[model samples]
Target: MKKIIVLFSLALLSFSAQAQEIKWMSFSEAIAAQKKVAKPIFMDVYTDWCGPCKMLDRNTFSDPGVVSHINQNYYAVKFNAEGTEEINFNGKKFTNPNFDPNRKGRNAMHEFTGFLRVPGYPSMIVIDEKGSVKKTMVGYKTPEQLRADI
Candidate 1:
């Protein structure tokens, strides 16, 4: 009985100590959430085939400080630059009409990505509560650097 209790306590402690992840929302969801709570949007624009984008997710974004800071201060959003999902931003509906499903690597950029004029993958776009772009950081950023930028 004592052994079972110890194992249960250990499992509970491990679960409580697990890493926290950012509560990522879609662009439209972030916009809607802004109306209710009025938080700036921290949009991560990435592509599936981008190496640096994956690195950002694994190294910087997974950091506890980065995750906490973003969740508390901003409405964290993850946008796929080459995805087919239609997004409505700035009173305009955007889509990747030219997206090739058969393509394995890089597909056509989403219309919203073009509208934002994103320089490349792993672009971190900060949008004000009013839905306007505040800052755009293009490239991989460490937790310290990202914390400083936001």
Candidate 2:
């Protein structure tokens, strides 16, 4: 009986490990991955304090179907809309020029977000392999909705 229980636990662990998961990476990492395999880029542009962004992460991104689809079809990127990190893309450097180091709540938007014309939080940007913007989806989206959009 103990051996059977151990075997069952091992099987459960292996199954969990094989479960589909979104490979969320930084913008630069996604770009590098695109160069290697030439897959489309799917970027999730969100803020740390945005409620909808958290919901999207929990509901849509965590869904097995969404995870499998994104992992298979695109290089997933997670970009903080109000972050201070510098991003170099298309021969230009982008940064959050007005980002405050002290203030808490909402912060200045990143330059790359503005460059991509993201008007609000929880924006989803899809880029072609050639580095051109293919589509920009705004607001919260369900797993089914995002799958259809993709």
Candidate 3:
């Protein structure tokens, strides 16, 4: 079982590496690259405790077709809304000072959670090439569903 899990993870990683190189860029990199690119942006808002987020990573985002489409049409940014990382966007800094580092789970909501206005886990915010919100989605989504959205 352990071997299977490891193999599965490795396979997913390899597929992710090949299927779509455009994914989860650092804040600064995303901002810089996206400014010059003509495609839209898909911001994946998630928390470690959210089961659906992991599922999306394992299933939906890993799909070769979905990955290809996203890579061609969007810049994917994985945002751990409850993470500890400090981020700056559009000349504004964002962080969560009250986030409990010692806590056991992914409950540390980032300051941008409120700013982006997403109210749920595994939320996907689609931004146009002009950096405007095109759509917002919460919970799990299949590759087919994502295709439909695009």
Error of 2 at 78 (Å): 0.5
Choose the strongest candidate by TM-score: 1
Winner of 2 and 3 under TM-score:
2
TM-score, structure 2 vs. true: 0.90
lDDT of 1 by residue, 46-72 (tens): 999999999999999998899999999
lDDT of 1 at 46: 98
Candidate 3 residue-wise lDDT at 69: 87
Encode model 3's per-residue lDDT on 1-150: one tens digit a residue.
Answer: 999999999999988677664456755566678778667778899988889999999888887788888877777788889876778776789998889877887565789888889989989998777657889998899989977876
lDDT of 1 at 3: 100
The true-versus-predicted C-alpha distance at residue 20 of model 3, in Å, is 5.7
Evaluate model 3: give its lDDT: 0.81
Q: Whole-model lDDT for model 2 versus the true structure?
A: 0.92
Q: Write the per-residue lDDT of candidate 2 for residues 9-53, one digit (tens) a residue.
A: 999998886565799898899888878889999999999999999
Model number with the top lDDT:
1
Listed per candidate, the RMSD to the true structure in angstroms reads: 1.8, 2.2, 6.8
> TM-score of every model?
0.91, 0.90, 0.80
Residue 146 in candidate 2 has what lDDT?
Answer: 94
